[model samples]
Target chain A: MRLVRQLFTVTGLILLSAGYAHADDIKLVNQAFKEVAVVNAKGEKEFKLVEPGTVVPKDEILYITTFANTGDQPATDIVITNPLPNNSRYKAGSAFGAGTEISYSVDGGKSYGTPETLKVSGSAGQTRAAGPDDYTHIRWVYTGELAPGAESTVTFRTIIK
Target chain B: MAGRGYKQILSRLAAVLLLGYMDSSFALGTAANTVINNTAVVDYQVAGVPNAVNASVAFTIEELLDVNVVSLDAANVSVVSPSSGRQLTFLLTNTGNGSEQFLLSVDTALAGDNFDPVPASARIWIDANGDNTLDTLNDILYNGTNGPVLDGSTPGNDAVAVFVLADIPAGRTAGELANVSLIATSVIADAAGEVNNVGAEITAGGDGGVDANIGVSGAQSSAIGTFEVVNSGVSIAKSVLVFDTQGGQDPHPGAVLRYTLQVTVSGASSIDNLVITDSVPANTTYVANSIVLDGVSQTDAGDAPGVDFSDFNISNANTVTVDLSQGGNITVVPPASFTIGFEVTID
Candidate 1:
């Protein structure tokens, strides 16, 4: 019975790897949170990354995600999608990433477009311009291929409501 | 072997269900100032294989609300005519733990005072520049046509200028008083009512939430404005002095007597047609130029220019009269006083 259990565990891991064959090669590293603060007298905001279990409200937070290609070959058409956390609204024009085209989703990732092109249904069934509160997801599409051992980071800001 | 497999499957199912529950429960939006858990999923394609990974973070919302309104400068104001834009000034402060918004309204028909026959329109103003003066440059009017949304303390301690404005109606008689009330309510209150009590936490269970202060002990604060119309006319005091060849040790038959009349005008409004008259005592002669209005000597000349009166007449050397209205141009107003001194002989 013990041998069979071990065999089953190994088989399970092997099948998991098979299903997500390329997932191990492209690793999604640690996720972090940064708060916007005005540390100087100039009324300018400085973003400082916070550890887990930090308190925030009515404040701007930058969510940063790091990913890397650990394989031997280059990775193509790398697209990463992240939903705006609950109780938070996206900060307009705050998405930052090199060589990436940013788009937003208003319908829980069902659709995507720039801020101006996005529309949301109002209470009276009328479609209006999508506000920060209507944002559901943020997507970053890397324009160029990422070579092996290459790491990239994407960040976007959201204000806790 | 079958039993073991069944146990493993059951354990896996439980784990999956528990994870699903946590994702559905904690991933949703919670109330303000409470712990909210959020998770983000990253989906990407690596070498033609689609993959996904997720991470979560928890944060507490900052929640604090305090507010207060300072006492007004004038609780009771006296006005003769019912006019528009009668203003009472006050200071609105946020004394709570967080920033908030306040909704202001006026109740002209509050109990305990005479209600205006027609309800007066009430409005508010902010001393934008903190000069405490309502002017074109510093005053911002908040009216019902376009309601005002006032901010309370948040980024810093906030003291706001608030004006209670009203209009008194015409024909408001003397001793008749009217009351006007200004009430400030928290905009975050669940309903449009007073929020005197501390709100409960959202995680504590039921649906009620905390609210901002409105300058009162409780959720709603109200200040009363009392307007009283009064009729204050004038008051006069009289004194006598006697002189003689012997220095007037007593009131002798040949002693000269001097009488002084002091007149005082009172009340908030101005008055017209102030007339003073005196009957000369028996055997006493009227002294010329003995009458004085605020230290200015007067003559017994009626309608004389620059004489301080339109008419000053002494009839039959026994009656003395002084008219203050100089042909409808001059009259004694409030905060004014005068003394009239004249000499007479005892018969």
Candidate 2:
């Protein structure tokens, strides 16, 4: 019977502890939560290459592209690729802008490898490596995420094949 | 003992019932509390014309330069209208690990000039559980008005609120970006939080740093293109001569000879604010009259166009006028057309 009384007392204590706020008491309280700002938009992007109707030796042919992040939310999954046109050839070592990868194909864009496959090589042997001279196509992808209302630029050079 | 036991049981049961009622009532009241946890009001900025290295190039914002996102503070962003008394349930989140209580505000001072800004007046909403309905809490406003413009002279203050939060998501994202968006009045330029980048940036203090002159504001970005110039020799073609003096045509010494002034921009870079001068050819003789360029009347303005020179003019006509071509105003209106009639005397 004593043990039973002790058990009841414990239960009563637990109930008193577990129960929050008592009757006949008015609780006036206020709390605030913050939200972090998110801007996940990359604006409208544009790219164009105007052809100059001339074939001069060593005269660098330029291709230009404009990029803008329009959405408030930043953008990811950046992929930049371009095939060297038939009448043109890529010059080695020219790539710029957000993030990018350059590839060359001796088979006319049918397949691409590092410069080494085309008889040119980089620090990593057997890799189709390219320099300012053996460029065919240009491509790049951004590794990092672009923030809201952000913009970047890209440019490359080539010669008439 | 039996009677005492029955009374004790009855008293205990009554106490239990009273406690149950109180618990139920307390729970119901606590659940009635409405506070928004998700909010999306945000801000950003673009570097000003002062930041641009190039000067000769006319400054225009084509894009919004963005910063790596850390989080969004939408405590002030609400969907409820102040007058409607609708509830606005806000959700505050951290897109990135960098959590802070950034100030959120609506300033109309920029609207007076920028043509757009956030809405005029808005209120906070409450989400009462079980009710599932939004209840209004506070109406947000910058200054006393619902405009982004403060005065014609000063920079506008942004409508702002401070929100405190613990975490946005489960993990700690160092580079997570956040946003706070709200419904905007048409009178305000921004219906959302800097939706179009048009020179938007984020700083410690919300200043929406942009200055405009003559309607055109600098964009966060701009573009440049280059073209080679191969100037061809001056164009010499047979000249067509006409004599008209208010419907009076006489080329024989008394006739006014009308000539055209033409100019063009052809060099690669675009040029405005130009001034060009062309002397009358030695073979042409004239007294006095008028001149113009491509529909635009010029007393003596820019003579340069992109790529090439398009400047040419005929002055010295007695009553007739000469204007420039694609180059600019060379057309003669009706009243002037009647005056454009004149016969020239061949030398």
Q: Which candidate leads in DockQ?
A: 1
Scanning candidate 2 chain A in windows of ten residues, the lowest lDDT window is A24-33
Choose the strongest candidate by TM-score: 1
Model 1 lDDT on a 0 to 1 scale: 0.61
What is the TM-score of each predicted model, taking all chains together?
0.40, 0.19
| Clash counts for all predictions | 11, 140
Q: Write out fnat for all predictions, comma-separated.
A: 0.29, 0.00
What's the C-alpha lDDT at position B218 in model 2? 18
User: What's model 1's lDDT at B257?
Assistant: 80
Per-residue lDDT of candidate 1, residues A18-114 (tens digit) = 6633334566644545442336677754433455233334445656666677766577777778888776777666676667899999999999999
User: Which regions of candidate 2 deviate over 4 angstroms?
Assistant: A1-58, A105-113, A116-135, B1-347
Q: For residues B165-197, what per-residue lDDT tens digits would candidate 1 score against the true structure? A: 777777777778877666665555425343665
